[model samples]
Target: MTYFPKLLTICILACILGATTFFYVKKSVYIFDTNYFKINSVSRAALKETGSKQCKNCSEGVPNLIIQYGVGRTATTLQFQILCLMMAFLHEDEINDVGCYYNRRNLVKKYNVIKCHDISWYLTVKWSKWVFMTSNHALLSRRLNYMRGKIKDKNTTIPFIADIDLVSRRGHYIVHEYQRFFGISDEKMQHIVEYLRYWDVLRVCCGMQMSADWRNHLAPKAKYKQHHSYHSPTYPACEMYNISQVEHLLVNTYVFKKLSHIGSLRDVIGKTSTVDGILNGSYCERCNTNISKMHLKFNQNCA
Candidate 1:
């Protein structure tokens, strides 16, 4: 009789702990169903974290088709809204594609206008990006473990936008926006940030995918440049990066974009003249002086 009472007490404590954790996750984290998530066709009510149909198999190919952006201050809100609206263009199958596929469209609407999508669609994209990134079994398992099945899918793509935002500092702004849009308490917002940072969806490295740093390790410097296009809009900004030690391109995007402006380029281009000369000629040399003027001259000669 004495042993039975002790066993019953232990069982009751275990049940209480389990119940507490279940409810905690239920209130804390949310995951979305990327399969049905589209930015354009949104029903905010559909995005509840019901704990059913949460895990699915990821696509087999490498995720080489992701649309990356640094999310600048001037363009942060506008870019997010634009991408959310653009999600409507994504095919159902593409939602879970490891290649991170999504369609792009013209920025036709007035950016300043407040539409329902500004909030709902923004959250939808956030969830979708994370879902695609976590398509892998191990990473998906890790994500589920972290969220504790309390994840909110928003049934749209809210987690996705938040996932990409995790890869950059600008993600802070997006989190704040989420709080304002949803009336999330400050404590809840901070809790969400902690969870996203701890799991790090952006840094979910795998054999099929690695960042520019790993690529440099495996391939020659020249090959790395060629593979990623040194002419990328963010190229000039990347030039200042200590590529020898850099690990994550997604992480560096916002850093370089913020650090290297026209004025900053002037210092860089001028210093190049003192060395072997990266530009070979005066194109980048005078880049700081008049990029538009030099660009026109080069284009005219080519024509």
Candidate 2:
């Protein structure tokens, strides 16, 4: 009997709470044939938080497994970037510990850290560390509505939601439990921030058609409307709710405030799909520079 069908059923239920945040343990594994996960006896690894300098050499034993799980619109992409940066500080061989290099789009590795929006996690007897990302319910709903272009006005709200209490508890966990878990030093943090800043800038450039090459490179198969970077101007225009509370809490916890410094609704509204369109935006040299740098970092030959 294949578990594929059952696994899909489990995925829908697990999507709500499992991916958002939770750790479970049980003595035995039994297919209850229900939504609940009957976690197996997997040894949860106790990792000692080490700074970037201390990670100069890889440990002798099996490298600790790190997994970051979250629902959509909870900054999963941003967290993925942060986790990748964290993975890079490890010894050269361990640097490829992540399952795949996003920039290179390669998967020749046994991933040390796994990021999943889907609650498809399974228990392995091997040691593992889990990081569950959560977001405020209001903020999450707003993001969802925006991404789907469902906004009508300030009163407009999305039916889907994030758990409020989980968001608060996770915020506290970030403060107390694993502040240095990623082992990012000050210098590394600065670089990560700069990288994030440039990343968003390039995103804005692509959205505004300031860099056609980047848009083509990033979303070759996607149409302008279907592009991952696509944003509806109505959502932003109608967004009167202040998600600043969540942003503030996240910034205090993870120092991820640079995200707000990126492009705005005007950029999205200004996008043009035509080659001959007289766009007000000009090509960004910095965007091209970062694109080349990224290509080089991923061992891709720059054009």
Q: Pick the candidate with the highest TM-score.
A: 2
**Where in model 2 is the C-alpha error above 4 Å?**
1-63, 97-111, 138-179, 203-303
* Model 2 lowest lDDT segment of ten: 39-48
Give the per-residue lDDT digits (tens) of candidate 1, residues 12-83.
999999999998886655433343344312222222331122222222221222232321222232233322
The deviation in Å at residue 268 for candidate 1 is 40
For each candidate in turn, give its C-alpha RMSD to the true structure in angstroms. Answer: 20.1, 20.8
- Clash totals in order: 26, 1
lDDT of each: 0.30, 0.35
